[model samples]
Target: MPKKVDHDERRRHIAEAVLRVAGRDGLDGATLRDVAVEAGISLGSVQHYFRNKDEMLRYVVGYLGEQVTARIVAGMRDHAAPGPVRSFLLSMAAEMLPLDDRRRAERRAGQAFTARAVDVPELGEALRYGDRWLHGRVAELIGRGGRDGELRPELDAEREAVVLLAMIEGLATDILLGMRDPGEATETVRYHLDRLTPQGS
Candidate 1:
C-alpha cells in the first residue's frame, strides 16, 4: 500500500518554506523552484500543491493571517487574566507588530504582498479582505470594553479600532524600515492604550 499523504502538513511545509525564502531574499526570490529547494521537496511536488505563482501568493496571505491569529491566541492564553479593554488592545497590537524574528519575517511577507497588491488582483482582494477582517475584530474587542464598563460608553469602538489598527500598522512599518525598535513600538502602543482607560481603573 502507498503511504498516505498528509495534504495539510504538506501545504504548511511549502508555505513555511515560502516564508523562509521571503525572509532571506524578499518575495521576488520565493519562486516555486526556490520554495521547493527550501522545503527539501521536489519542484513537481510544490507545483502539485500550487498550480502557479498567483495561487501560491494568495494562499500565503491567508497562511500568514493564520499564523498571526495563532500567535495572538497563544499570547492571550499565556496572559490569561482579567480581560481589561486597554490591555486587550495592547496585546492585539503587540501581536501585529514585528517584535521577534518570526514576526519580522511575517512583516516582510506582508509588505511584499502589499507592494504587489497594486498590480495583482487576487493579492489586492486578499489585502482588502484582511483589512476588513482586522477592523471588524478589533472593533468587536473594543466594543466588549464598552460592555465591561472599562472604556467610556460614548467611545466609538469602530473609530477607535481603526485608529489603533492604523497606529499598529504604522509601527510595524516603522520597525521594518528601521525607524523604530520593537520596544519603542510596543511602548508607544501601550502609552496610547493608557489614555483609553480611567486613571484608577
Candidate 2:
C-alpha cells in the first residue's frame, strides 16, 4: 500500500511557506526556488501547488482575506448579546493587525504582496474583487447589527464599514512599521465607534 497523502496539510504548509518567503525576503524575493527551499519541498512540488509566482501571490492574499473575515465572524458571534456592537467589531478587526510576532510576520508578507500586485494588472483585479467581497460582507454584518438595535440607527453601514475596514488596514500597516501598537489601534477604533452609538442603543 502507498502512503496516504495529507493533501490539506501539505497545501497549508506550502501556503505558509509562501508567506514566510514574502516576510523574510519581500515579495519579489519569494521566487520558486526560495519558496521551495524554505518549504523544504522540491521545486516541482512547489510548482505543483502554484503554477507561477502570480498564482502563489494571489493565493496568499486570498488566504489573508479569508482569515480576517473568519475572525470577524467569530467575534461577532461571540459578542452578539452585548449591548453595543463596537467591542465585537473591534475584536474582529484586530485580527488584521500585527498583534503578536506570528501575526506581524503575516502582516509583513501581505503588505509586500499588496505592493507588488499593484503593478500586475491581473493580480490587482483579483485582489480588488476579494477586497470588494470582504467589504460587502462586513457591511452586511454591520447593517444587521443596526437593524437589530445593537448599533446606531443613524449610522451609515456601507460607508462606516468601509471606513472601519480602511482604518484597520492602515493601522495594521502602521503597526508593522513600528508607528503604533496593536492595542492602541484597537482603542482608536473603539473610541470612534463609541461616539457613533445611538443614545440608548
Best by lDDT: 1
Those runs of model 2 whose alpha carbons end farther than 4 Å from true positions after fitting are 79-84
The C-alpha stretches of model 1 lying farther than 4 A from their native spots are 73-82
Lowest summed lDDT across 10 adjacent residues in model 1 is found at 76-85
Using Cα atoms with residue i matched to residue i, what is each candidate's TM-score against the true structure? Answer: 0.91, 0.86
Model 2 scores a C-alpha lDDT of 0.78
**What C-alpha lDDT values do all the predictions have?**
0.85, 0.78
In the range 1-201, model 1's lDDT, one tens digit per residue, is 999999999999999999888877898999999999999999999999999988998998889878887867676565455476577678788788989988888888888889988999889998898788778877877777777778766779999988899999999999998999999999999988777775687
Candidate 1 Cα RMSD after full superposition onto the native fold (Å): 2.1
Clashing pairs in 1: none
Q: How does model 1 fare in lDDT?
A: 0.85
How many backbone collisions does model 2 have? 0
What digit string (tens of lDDT, one per residue) describes model 2 on residues 37-118? 9999999988888899888777777776666667767776776563455666767667777888667778888778678877
